[model samples]
Target: MPPHAPRRRARTRRSIARLRSASIDAFAIWRRRLLFLVGGICVGLAAVFMAKLADAAQAAFRQILAISPLLALVVTPAGFGVAALLARTVFPNSQGSGIPQVIAARHTHDPALRHALISLRVAFGKIVVMALGLASGAAAGREGPTVQVGAAIMAAFGRLTPQRLPGLILAGGAAGVAAAFNTPLAGIVFGIEELGRTYEARTTGLIVAAIVAAGLTSLWLVGNYTYFGTTDAGLALGGSWLLVLVLGFAGGLAGGLFSRIVILFGRGLPGRAGAWIGRRPVAFAMLCGLGVALCGLASDGASYGTGYEEARAILHGDAAARLDFAPLKFAATVLSSISGIPGGLFAPSLAVGAGLGAALRDLFAEVPIGALVLIGMVSYLTGVLQAPITSFVIVTEMTQDHAMMIPLMIAALVADAASKLVCRGGLYHVLAEQILARADAPAEPVRRTA
Candidate 1:
């Protein structure tokens, strides 16, 4: 009724509209947050599922060994062949450790191409084939494959909204690492050091949220436990630290040689040999499986599967096979990597590092066996990944060994330098480049069958 009534009414209308708009914006923001949380939980469940299956598969293989160790000669080869065939035909992108595929997926700008690399289908195949490789006695790990699957799952969530999908991919991978190892800090470090190579402020919340969710999920399912049992041994600055230098150099050299060999095969062998292998990939995989079977025989089955049990035994100073376990495990991992089957190097690499450390017990009698094993693990892992921060962080987290942090860092630096001397690039990045190149290449025309 008053002259100012219309103006007041208009102001109230504007206020209500603003409130509605704010509510909508808030809902959208929380929606994406919820999606990320749920996705991370899913990633953790997937990691646990894959891990259980891997353990079961390894157990099954051990049973076969009990029945007759010679059975691996037939079983491993056939398993390798089947895995390779499935990867090549049914799950084209689900090959190798899957980390390289995640890396490649992150770099590509094409949404469709990225989707293809990290699709759910590819994740499914990775789980199945990776298990098959382990069940057949291939020396491999499940961690790297978990990374790919996690990334794919997170990317799927990202698709539901117009959020930063690439960042989601990176976060998924970090979550995978966290859930798989139950090491949240290591996951963030790996995201920065290996996955992203630099920090993104906007993605920080996403990474933390995903990691917390996934880490909590994993803890809930499996309960708290260190990847390797806790070691109270400390490394002093004087004589004890000398072992760090020795193991650093040795582990780095060995690790670099491994990366070089795997890369060489990835690039294809020279001349006719390369062509022959290319033409008969399944057969080559069989040969590689046979090589792994021999390694297992030599190591008294210690070199088979992920080598986790053997590594743990040596690290804790318990009884384990000691017949050049490190070298044979190394050889088996290299073969599994290049055999066109789905598997990971994380567990196997740690197993090799543990073996290497235990073998040098005579050189550093004063150093606790645990200290030596820790150094060797950090050194070799950094050497292979060429990620000093990630290598040391993950190892430190796995063992909860703050006493050896300084020693581990120094060893990581040494190993990185030594690794670069033999290997020009980090393993995952190099393989990622190869993957991108292959993806960009024009697809071969399908041959018509009459």
Candidate 2:
């Protein structure tokens, strides 16, 4: 061999050796991470199961009070106050949907950490707030807080441990929702498609596991009922398909309007009354309580809670003066929602869409109310979340009716498109913007080390 060839071969060998060493180091680090993740998943799933039990307890408590909504409404503020204080004191990062927190955490581009408060206190606070909010006629749902509760439980179990990557967090998040709502596949889909923002093979497995774990937890406690008791009235075929198209169009328009109005109020109220309310949360909550109480008295306690009864009424085609009540329910719900009382918009949104759908179905007099209600659900959900596929899937899953798939797809697509045209952000995104904007406000500079 030439002298130069021998020298080049030696150089190549050293380079290859260096590469091999680097690869080995990377693998070692990855293995440790993998091990930690497996441990976190075990810990997180356990926590999720426990939280589901707590949530079940809360649900039972709410049901007991639901028998006397007026009196129950009064008790909600106390719950909210305690929850708010705990949340502020303990898991401040856990405030709101907490979807944003996990989303932010997943982004390597973002630099932040969970404090001791977020893992324990925040989750508890959310539970208290959510329960109280539900009791008090807050036009919100429990899913968001429950999701946080699950995440917090996971974080607590895995504390002092190296951070799991975004995938684990996403898995935990999915499990949280699955456990809360008793919808495992939806939870899996939500984790992979909605929250995780990917459907890769690896992510699908982790999320599916988490969802299964969560669903098992929920089924053990809550029984396997869908959140809404949607009727299985078959979808209209042939001539009725036209009605579905009409419902889809109508739902899209209504959903778009609802989305716009929420944004308008959420933004307009701010810069004016929000600061005042912030200064006097107790007073604002009291006023809200009174307003909700008065609404109950006016409607003879009809316009309260998550609108479950109203939804049933719509489903049965037994609604009387529902059109008039729709506006009131919408107003009450929107105000309660914007007031920052801990609740979920999911149920309220569903209720709103149902009311609208029922009204339209009555007007048409040809289409089945069930079909319209389902369309309305997809419409409003698509508009709010701007996730037509998720919305449609959730509605279909909730109702367990495959016949309306075509109509749902049509309505969802239109509603999402319309919402996008009118609004710059989806429901959670708008909320997230407010949250991050609040968080990202320039912190007072600390003195630098020399």
Candidate 3:
């Protein structure tokens, strides 16, 4: 027998163990990546599903209007009432824009609480209720609700593995924005500026990977296209720049007021009025629906649905947007939002901005209408979300207009300041806090259904 035989066998055993350890580690890493990739693809598909649903709903509602413009008074209120009832009873956490619920889920430590906020059930309810609202001609957007749905899907996937990654929810949300708008860069910016509030190096890969996957999926289905189309509008630093200042400040203040009203309603109205709304939320939702119907009448059906077509036309200089469309759209969006129906504010806000810009286009006839429209968009969006970078990036990506970046950035800054003057808190963050408070104080006489 050779003495070296024992040492050789030991070395072989060590090599085998090392290979096994490396294989296990590699498998785990690959599994996590696969989850993220699959989750991202799912999010993209969900975005497409949601967009198609919203489009079909709006088309159906338009047909109803063709039959009789006044029919919305009945259809809208009745539909809003049902949506509110379902949100209250069957989907307690599926009310409003759904962005708030995602934000709340991110902040919460309790797994159960987060589950309640961004669960599969809540995601399904969000889709159904949001579609119903759109079908009823409610002035709302689907983009925001898409964020919640994406987050829920990603969170559910996260639970499949023993090692839970906290940023999966955030990544999912960012991916949703990417797929919904086909704007990958804006998704990254939103994930950093709006959702996570800070850059996480570890999750950056996950975020980018998810965004790319989702964007590819959406592009494959919907084809490559900009949200607002291409524009050659530029803002030189001269007399035309003054429009930026004027429109920026005005849009910001208006956007700020919108956010303030929403927050106030979310906290419930003051005293007896609040109590009354609390007791009969479904009825109040119906009232709000009626208000939206009136806005629709005033706008000649322009204020219904997501306001996407209206905004797109105005941006492209194809439509003579009504002078009062901005304010009416604003009122309708606020009413739909406070009614506690499931819908998003992004498209309606842009519609209001487009109308506002069109209204001011006469005053600045020398300025390019596209420039004013672009400025109005950045200003108002920045004001609503209090996320300047996200707002500018999204508008830039949507319009595919790099020439307006400088003015848009400046406008966003101005809007951010003006918005803070009216409403100190960001809309989603404030709503998220209220959600947390309600969850913590469940015994309190808080109206979750509303």
| Residue 154 lDDT, candidate 1, scale 0-100 | 96
TM-score to true structure, per model: 0.95, 0.76, 0.96
Task: Point to the candidate with the largest lDDT.
Answer: 3
The number of clashing residue pairs in each candidate reads 0, 2, 0
Model 1: residues with Cα > 4 Å off, grouped in runs: 1-14, 320-323, 441-450
Per-residue lDDT tens digits of candidate 3, residues 92-189?
78998888888778878778889999999999999999999999989999999999999999999999998878788998999999999999999999
Stretches > 4 Å off in candidate 3: 1-12, 441-450
Q: Against the correct fold, how does model 1 do in TM-score?
A: 0.95
The sequence of per-residue lDDT tens digits that candidate 2 reaches over residues 1-450 is: 677998999999999999999998898656545543553344345444544544564466457556775564566455445545544554465444566555444432333444332355666666666665655555566666666556655555444445444455666666766665556666766665555556556555555655665666556555678766656765656676665556556656655666566656445456658788667655666666566555655565556666765776776667743565555666666656545456655566777778777777646667778887888778876776677777787777777778878888888887777767666566665554444455663322211101
Which order, best to worst by TM-score?
Answer: 3, 1, 2
Q: For residue 152, what is the lDDT in candidate 2?
A: 58
